[model samples]
Target: MYSNTSELAEDKLLLLYLLDKIKLPISNNKVTEIILENNFINYFTLQQYLTELANANFINYIEQEGKHRIIVSNKGLKVLSLFRNRISEVKIKAIDCYLKKQMESIKKEIAISADYTIEGNNYIVNLKAVENNSILIDLKLNVASNKQAKDLCAKWKKNSSKLYNELFKVLINN
Candidate 1:
């Protein structure tokens, strides 16, 4: 989508720099949200850049728990180190500030997750909590209706930590 070679290269470097700063595997949706929210690049252009970066071994895309996640490759870090100056200091500072403000929400987004699927006459809800890339809790429930499943997921997202602590207390007391 970019007509200028330098611009394309610089944008790719910008992405790499972002991933390096994150230092964690990020879901595709999260990456898209950040880039689009910042108005750094259009959706189609971002897709193309992601594909090119993955193909060139500059970024690694992996599927886990049915989600697509991306992380910067070692080669990408090297490239960023060499070309990061192409990205303006203003852009870098903006990213740093934004990350600082949103890192907690981002971590919660990555760590707490819930989803549902229809199974026969029931809805199967899956709720999970993760820390440091390790599973802290994984719970599945079979509900009679979609509304029940949705409510369960919402509650799980909001109260998973409290529930986990309570569950732990109950189990230990027994």
Candidate 2:
């Protein structure tokens, strides 16, 4: 219930993910396998985090099949959206705004619906520590070999020609 703990945020994410995986209140084997596959944490370390999670009341259960059979408490799922928004490497809203302007020239895809998230490189911009810079720019832009990304950048930069040339130059060179 307490969200103030440092581990609570990450623990909350794990709880939600695990709960989704074992929707039927599974035993330890199934839960542990899912956690390992997702790379939430290594086996040894997860044990420690699990204790913290129990203390935080995100998830609590007995160990079965040599692993923890976890479930997401209501208090746990409550923090998921907050953690997702806070820890996300890319801010979805900013990317949507930037991509909306840049990709206008390209074929539209669903017009930025609510589910749009920074799940992949195509729609993602590593926004961690990204401050005091143009909205659309990111290090991942360097890996874009496709015309869509290039053209989108060009269109955006072209639109802002008088205000700044740095963005336009990047698009032009690409």
Q: Note the Cα lDDT for every prediction shown.
A: 0.88, 0.46
| lDDT by residue (tens digit), candidate 1, 1-78 | 457888888788889988998887898788889889988889999998999999999999987667888999999998
What is the Å distance of residue 159 in model 1 from its true position? Answer: 2.6
User: Evaluated with lDDT, which candidate comes out highest?
Assistant: 1
Candidate 1 weakest lDDT stretch, 10 residues = 1-10
lDDT of 2: 0.46
Candidate 2: RMSD over Cα atoms?
Answer: 17.4
lDDT of 2 at 54: 69
**Candidate 1, superposed: residue stretches over 4 Å from native:** 1-3
Candidate 1 Cα lDDT to native: 0.88
Candidate 2 lDDT over residue span 116-156, tens digit each: 12344654322111112223323333333345555544554
For model 2, the stretches where C-alpha displacement exceeds 4 angstroms are 1-8, 62-68, 86-174
Error of 2 at 145 (Å): 65
TM-score of 1: 0.92
